[model samples]
Target: MKYLLQGFTMGLAYVAPIGLQNLFVINTALVQKRSRAVITAMIVIFFDITLALACFLGVGAIMEKSKILELGILLVGSIIVIYIGYGLIRSKGVMEKTADVNIPLKKVITTACVVTWFNPQAIIDGSMMLGAFRASLLPEEGVNFIIGVMSASATWFLGLTLFLSIFKSKFTDNILTWINRVCGVVIVLYGIKLLYSFIEIVKGY
Candidate 1:
């Protein structure tokens, strides 16, 4: 229980920031039907949990041993992330009776995967934070601790979905469009940062 609570709190802190994952979830909830938004959140939660597990389980170590592999991932992920941001920036943000023009499921899944697993910030931060915590845990406590973390991810995403749905009416097309543009800018900046990191790594070798 102690480990669980600790993980829960840590997890909340880890994911609470207004990054790609949160922005994606928020936009979906704000623009889509409740059922579709819920589904989107569920997909995001699955990827978030898996990504957290990968980070906590020494995937970062494997990448660290191969600079080429790490650089390749960062480069590819950055391009994709930047492209996603461009799409968001171009989106019309039409919400209301016509809000049913939903994104395809496959696209949603792909976007969620990219924003969670392929996101450089999520990768670097999760690896540093959760990986360090993993190193300090007793073998027996690992499961509970991670479960707690996963629980936090679920709660936060689902809660955000619920909250936005409740107040979704408050958002106008203009407001949603502005939100999209802002989030797009942030995501593009993240991609640019990752690209810059890739160049920095190249400089070292």
Candidate 2:
């Protein structure tokens, strides 16, 4: 019980940050159909679970020891994130009233995967925080902790989607456009921050 609570609290804290993954999910929910948004949410949750498990199972140790790997990930991930943010900022308007902006399922899934997996912050959170937490638990307690983390992730995504679905009608088209612009700016800033961090790491070597 204690381990479960600890894991849940930590997971929520990590996931609650407004990063690329969360922004992607929220944008999907706001622009796409409810069904499509749900699918995207599921993909995000799937990756979250996979990452948490990998970290808890010692992938974090490998990542920590490999500066080259970390640098490569940060470089590519920052570029991808920044590119996506630029696209968002360049878009003319929101598709809130129409399905014109609805992209194919494959593209949605692919983007979600990229945003979730290639996010440097997400990688660090899963590897450092989750791994460190797992290291503190007994073998038997590990499963409970994992379950708690997964539960928190599932709850957060679902709640986010649900909230968006309910309030989506309240947002005007201009408001939606502004929201997109704001999210894009934030994402781009995060990408730039990741790039700067990567450069700092490289300089140390």
Candidate 3:
């Protein structure tokens, strides 16, 4: 029970904050292609959960084998985060609005998979935080930890979908720009946090 609660809390912490993907989904929802956006969001969540499971099971042994391995992971993760943050900050453009648009489900899924899975920070975040945290619990508590992570993602998706649906009519390019800018700031903050952790690791070495 305790482990489950902890898992849920940790999941909330990791997923609740505004990030690049969150902004992407939110903007997608505001557009006429809500279905496509929702599908993309689901794809991201699916990959996140799968990676979480892999990290939970696969990385524990590596961590135990060598402290350097763990530090290296963190360093690499921090660099990726910083690079992503820079991209977001420098990004300047608009998503072209289209009417009578048709996007294939397969294409949407593929794009989302690339965006989510290719992100090194996402992998590290899941492996180091969600994966390791869940493994710390007893066998019976596994369900709860998984539940927590799933719940966090589900809640975000549902809430974002609802919000976009409600305000879809009011959303405009300007609103999207604002959302993107704010999300950019949040992403930069995440990058800074990651960099700080890397510095700590370096100092320890």
Candidate 1: lDDT over CA atoms? Answer: 0.74
Question: Could you give candidate 2's per-residue lDDT for residues 42-132 as a string of tens digits?
Answer: 9888988777787667743554566565566567656765765676576544433332326787887777777878877667646644554
In order, the Cα lDDT scores of the candidates are 0.74, 0.67, 0.60
TM-score of each: 0.63, 0.61, 0.59
Native-to-model Cα distance after best TM-score fit, residue 185 in candidate 2, in Å: 25
Report the Cα RMSD per candidate. 8.8, 8.7, 5.9
Query: Which candidate ranks first by TM-score, i.e. highest?
Result: 1
Ranking by lDDT: 1, 2, 3
In terms of lDDT, the poorest run of 10 residues in model 3 is 93-102
Runs of candidate 2 with Cα error greater than 4 angstroms are: 59-101, 169-205
Candidate 3 colliding pairs: none
Ranking by TM-score: 1, 2, 3
Kindly list the per-residue Cα lDDT of model 1 for residues 16-80, writing each as its tens digit: 54567877887888778889999999999999999899887774455546656566666765676
